[model samples]
Target: MWDDVFPIDQVQEIRTKTTVYLGAGAIKKIYDIAKDLKEKGVDNVLVVTGRSSYKKTGAWDHVEKALKEQGMGYAVYDKVTPNPTADSVDEATKMGKDLGANAVIAIGGGSPIDAAKSVAILLEYKDKTARDLYELSFVPQRAVPLVAINLTHGTGTEVDRFAVVSIPEKEYKPAIAYDCIYPMYSIDDPELMTGLSLDQTKYVSIDALNHVIEACTTKTANPFSILLAKETVRLIAKYLPKAVENPQDLRARYFLLYASMIAGVSFDNGLLHFTHALEHPLSAIKPELAHGLGLAMIVPAVVEAIYPASKDILDEVLEPITKGAEGAEEVAKTLEKWIFSVGVTSKLEDEGFKGEDIPKLVKLVRETPSLDGLVSLAPVEGTDEVIKKIYQRSLKPIA
Candidate 1:
C-alpha cells in the first residue's frame, strides 16, 4: 500500500526510537527515567546544555535533582551556542568521555540536543575529533545513549538522527545524520518552554513550520509524511500566534511542541530543500541571527521560484496555510503575510546579509557536504545561478 504512492527508494522507513513523555509537567518524568537507567546499570551521565537558559528556567535543577536522587554521577558541558560549532562538540565529547558517561542528558533547545547527538557519536569514536566526524572519515563504533529534554519547540533534534554543526573559521555549517544519534528517550515539557522570550517562541515556531513545509514538498515525501506535514502546518498556523501573544498559555505551547515533533518525524523520512540549504550559510556566517528569521526572509522567494515545478504539493498546502487559497502565487503571498504578521521582518539586509556576502554564502553552501544533494531534491534545480538569485531576492523583503 505504501509503495503504491511512493517509489521503493522514496518509501519511508518508520521507527520510534525515542520514548517521549509530553505535556505540562513532563519534566518530572526525568526521575522515572533516571531510576530506570540506574536499574539498567547506566552509571555516569553527561548533562549537555547551552548558556544558562536551562539554569534560568530551573529545568537543569529538576534534571540534576532527579539524577542526584538516583545517585547517578554526571558532568556538565554547557558551552554550546546557537548554530553550535564542531569545536564545541569535540570539547563536550572529551568531557563526556573523561567522565566515563554511559549516557547523555540533552537539555534545552536544538543547539544543546544537536551538540549532545554529535557528542554521543564522538564519545564512542575515541580517536577522532569532530572535524574527522564532519569529514566522514570515521564512523562511530557505538553511540552513547541519549535522553533529550526539549525546552524549546524547534529543530526536532530530540526525535531525529540529524545534527547540524558549524565550523566558524571556514564559515561552514554542515549537517550530520547517523542512525545511532537518535535519542533513546525525549521529554517535551511545555513548562520548560514558558520562560522563552516572545522572539524565541516565534522564531522556533517558524523553524518547525519550515521543517514540515519543506519536507512535504520534497521529492521523497510519501503519503504518511504529507499527512503529518499538513496537520503540522495547520497546527502551527493556529497555535503559534496564540503562543507568541501569550507566553503563559501552556496549551498553545504544548501543541506547538507537538507540531515540532510531528514535523521532525515527517522530515526524518522526507528530506528538506533549498530553504534549509539557503538558511545554513546565513546562520553559519551570522551566528547571532536566529535561523527561523533567515527562513522567513528566504522562503517566499524560494516557494515562488520552485512553484512551477512543485505545484502539486505546493497547491495542496494552500488550504492548510490559507484556508482554501488557490494558486501557488496566492500561497506564497499568504505565507509572506503570515510571516510578517508574526513580527518577523523579512529582509536579509536588515540582518546584515549584504550583496558582498552573497558570493561567500553561496561558496559556503557549495562547500558544505550533502547539502547540494538535499538542495537538488527540490523541484527547482539549486544551481549556482539559482542560489545566487535566491540570496539576492532575500536581501530585499519577500513580497
Candidate 2:
C-alpha cells in the first residue's frame, strides 16, 4: 500500500563502504558477487543467518574461511524466527547496529530475509514510534546493505517493497505492512531446499498453491495475475508432489520454487482474497492453527462460495488443477481430490475449532476487507448469509 521505492541503491552505497559477505550455498554466486563488491574496494563484511545455517550447511565455514583467507573479518547473526514480529525485528536491528556491521548478507527462507529488511528499516529509523514505522511517516534515509541468499522460495518478499509484521496484540491480530524493499539482491537456489523432508517441502509448496489460487480468484483479478496464478498452479500441481516424493529432484524443486516466487510476485501486485483474510483472523484468535494449514482448511470453502460467481474462470482455473475433469461437480470433486492429495483436509474441527465458532468465524469473514474482492468476482455477492452458509458447509466431512 505504501508507494515508496526500495532504497537498494542506497544499500549498494553501504556495501561500497564495506567488504562483502556471502554464504548459504550461494557461495558460488556469492563468490562472483562478493568478489565484484570486493574489487570495488569494499572492506568490511558480515553474514546474517541462523545457527543450523552455519552448523549444518557448511556454507558458513566455507565463506568465513574464504573471507578470512582474503583478510576480511566476518561475524554471523543467526537467531530469528518464523512470522517475525516487530519486536524481533527491533532486536535484530539492535544487534546489527551494535556490531557496526557495514553491510549485511542474509541467507534463508522468507522469515530471515523479511527480518533483515525490517532490521534495515528499524535500524535506520530506530527513533520512530512503531505506529510511525507502520505509517512510513518517516522515510529511512540510511540502510544497511542486505542481500538475501534464499533457501526456501515462497513470498518473493525478496524483491517486493513490502513486509508482513504480525501484531498479535491487535484485536484482529492483523499483519502490519512495512513497505521496506531492503533485500538489495536475492540468490534463489533450489539446491538449498533439496534437503527438505518431503512433508516440509509439500507443506510450503501447498502454501504457494494457496497464494496462487487466492490471488487468481480475488476480486482485483487482472489479466497478468490470472496467468501468473494459473501457471503457478500448473507448476505446483505437476511438481510439488514430485519434489515431495523425491526431495533430491532438482528440477522439481526449481519448478515448485519458481511457482511460489511468481505467486509472491502476483500477490505483491494484487492481494489475496477471502481465504487469507479469514485465515489471519483465525491465526490471531488461535496460535495453534498455522497459517498454511489454516489456508488449506478454507480454500475449498472459498471455492464452493465463489463457485457461482465465475464458474467459467473457476473452471479454467481449476482445469489444470483438476486434470481436465468434466462438469462443474466433477471439477469440484477433482479439486477436492487434489486438496487431499497434497494433504490439506478442511479438518479444522480436528484442529479443535468447534461448531459454536462457525458463526463467529462467519462474522469474522463477513466484515473482512479481503473478502470485498470476492464480492464482485464471485457470481453471487459474498453476503453474511452466504458466508454463514459456507461456514455451515465447511463443517461437513471433506469426503
Candidate 3:
C-alpha cells in the first residue's frame, strides 16, 4: 500500500541539518553516535527525559549500554513533565552546568526533547535562564550539541528546529525555532514506540495530523509543504487504526513515525496557524491537558473557519479523511466524525472548560508572546472574534 501511494524508491530523505537514523534497529546506532560526540570534545553529557518513558520504553537500556561502552560521563534529569515548564528546563540546565556537561541527549517524546533544546541553549549561554529563552529575552545563536532518541511518533522535534516550553506562572506556552536547536543526531526506531498506550498512539498521530493540516493551510505554504502534508495525512489515515488496535504493530508504527517526521519538516518550512496557536493556550491554562488532545478538540472548528479560504488545497490534503466531502460545513463534520472514531470523545466541557472560558483562551492567544505570530500565519484573518468562535465551537462535541 505504501508503495502504491508513495513509492519507496521515491521516498528519499528530505535533507535537513539533522542527521537522522530511522528504522527497526536504528537505536543501535546510539553507540556510534556517542563515540562520534566524544571525539568532538563532548565529555560529560546531560540526558534529559520524562520520569518513566526512558525506562518504560526500554530505550534507556540501550542508551545506557552505548554511553557506558563509549565511556561517556552523563547525568540524568528525568522530571520533564508533559507541557514542560521553563522551571523544569532551568532545573535541568543547572544540573547540566553542575556536571560540566557539553552535550544533551533527549529521550522520550516532544516534551523531553523540547525541554532538552532549551537546556542545550542554557548550557552554552551559562548565564542565561530558560525564562530568557522562553520569553524571547535573548535570540539564541548557539546550543550545546543535542541528540534525540525519540520514543514516540509525534511532535517531529527530532527533525525540526522548533521547541515549545511553557511558563505556567504566566500562563504562556510559546515555541522557539532556531537553527541551532536541531538535533545534531536523532534516532527514530519503531521498536521503541511499541510500548505506547492506545491513547498515546492516537493522540500523537493526531498531533502529526494537525501539524500537516496547519502547515499546508498557512499563508506561507509552498509546494513542498503541500506534498508532504498530503502524504502525512494519507499515512496517518491508513496506519493509525492499525496501531491503535495493536500497539506492537511495528509496520504501523514505522509509517506513523515517518508521517510525523515529515509533518514536522512541513510545518518547519510552512509554519502553523490556528490549531497550534490556540491549542498551546489550552494546554498552558490546564497543564494536565495533552497537547494532541487539545488539538483534537479544536481542529474541526479550525477547519470550519479556514476551509473556505483554502478549500481546493485542503480538499486535496484532507481527502483521505474527508472522502470527497464538499463545502466547509460538510468537511468539518466529516473531520469531527473521524476524530470521534479515533476514540477522542471529549468535548472542551468534558475537559473542564466552558463557554465562559472562551474569552480567557482568546486572550491567551493574542497576549501570549509567540502565539500572535502563528495567528498572523492563518490564511484568514485571525481576529479576536474569529479566535473566540473557534473556541466556542469546540466547547461542545459536534452533533
Candidate 4:
C-alpha cells in the first residue's frame, strides 16, 4: 500500500543538520543521545512539555529513565499551553537558567518544542528576552543543543528550524526561523502518538496539509518542495481519515507522521505564504483556538485567491484532495469539502470570530513581525484589502 503512494525505490535517508531517529521504539535512542550530550558537557537539561501529554504519550517515562541512567540533572517546565505565548517561554527560560541547564529536551508536539526552542535561545543568550526573540529585536546566532521527542504527527517542529510564539499584549503571533534552533537530535516514534484524541488527529493533519499547500505555491518554491508537497498531500489524504477513525492504528499514525516530517522539510526549503501568514493572527487573538483549525478556516480563501497565480503547481500539489476539480473556485470548494469531511466543520464564525473582527485580524497580520515576510512570499500580492477579503470569506460556512 505504501509503495503505491511513495515507492520503495525512492525511500532514502534525509540528510539534514538534525539527526532523526524514526520508527517504532525510536525513543529508546534517547539513552544513547543523552549519554552523548553528557559527554559534550551537557550536565543538566531543561525538559519542556505541556502538562499532560508528556506522560499520556508515554514519552516522559523513556525520557526520565534516560536522564537518570546518564546521571544528568534535569528540570521540567510543563506549563506550556496551546498557542504558547512569550510569557510561557519567558517562564521556561527562567527555569532553565536557574537549573543551569546546558541542553533542552522538548517532549511534546509543536507547542512545547517551539517553546523549548525559544527557551534554548534565551538560555544561550542569557541577556535576551522572549519579547526580543518574537519581536525580531535580536538575530539569534546560536543556541544550546536541543533534543526533540515528538509525540504528535504534526507541526514537524522536531525537525524544522521554526518556532512560533504569541505576544498577546501586542496581539502578535509571529514565527521565527533560524538555523540555530533546529534540534540536534530528534525522534519520530509513532508508538507515542496512539494517545492523541480524535480532534488532535484531525487538526494536526490539517496543519500538515496547510504547510505543503503554502510551501509549493510560495514564490521560492522549487522542484524539491513540489515533490514533497504532493507526497505529503497524498499521505495525509489517505491516512488522516484512518487515524481519525481508529486513533490506535499505528500504520496510519506512521504515515501521517512521515507526511508531517516531509511537510516540515518542504516548507523549510520552499517557505510558506498566505495561509500561515493569515492564520497566526486568528490564533493570536483567540489563544484557545487550535492553530490547525485556524489554518483550515483560512486556507480555502487563500487557495481561491492564489490559484490564478499558481494554477499549475497548486493543481498538481492538491490533486489528492482536489480530485480532478479544475479552476480556482472549484478546486477551493473541493478542498473545503475535504476539510469538512475530516470533521473540521466549523467556520470562523462558529469559532467565535465575526465579520467585524476582520479589520483587527488584518491589522494583526500587517503589524505582526515576520508575518509580512510570509505574506510577501504569496504567489499573489497579499495586500491589506486582499487579506481582509480572505477573512471575510471565511467568516461563515462555505456556500
For model 4, the local distance difference test gives: 0.90
Q: What is the lDDT of residue 354 in candidate 4?
A: 88
lDDT at residue 167 of model 4 (Cα atoms) = 94
lDDT of 2 by residue, 1-399 (tens): 121232211222112111222222444556556665566554555565665754455455556655665565566667766555556666666676676655667667666776676666665665754335543456665655666676765665555555554544542333334344546556655657777655557657777777767666677777776788888887877887777677787767766766776777666655666666666657656754556667667667777677666577777765678767655456656666786887666567767777788777766555432334434444456677766665554565444
In order, the Cα lDDT scores of the candidates are: 0.83, 0.61, 0.91, 0.90
Best by lDDT: 3
Model 1 earns a TM-score of 0.93
Residue lDDT tens for model 1, 28-125: 77888899889888899999999899898778888999999989899999899988898899899889888999889999899999989888887787
lDDT at 254 for candidate 2?
A: 68
Per-residue C-alpha lDDT of model 4 across residues 208-282, encoded as one tens digit per residue: 999999999898999998999999999999989888888888878888988999999999989999999999998
Model 4 segments more than 4 A misplaced: 3-14
Runs in model 1 with CA error above 4 Å? 1-15, 324-327
Model 4 per-residue lDDT at 384: 93
Best-to-worst order by lDDT is: 3, 4, 1, 2
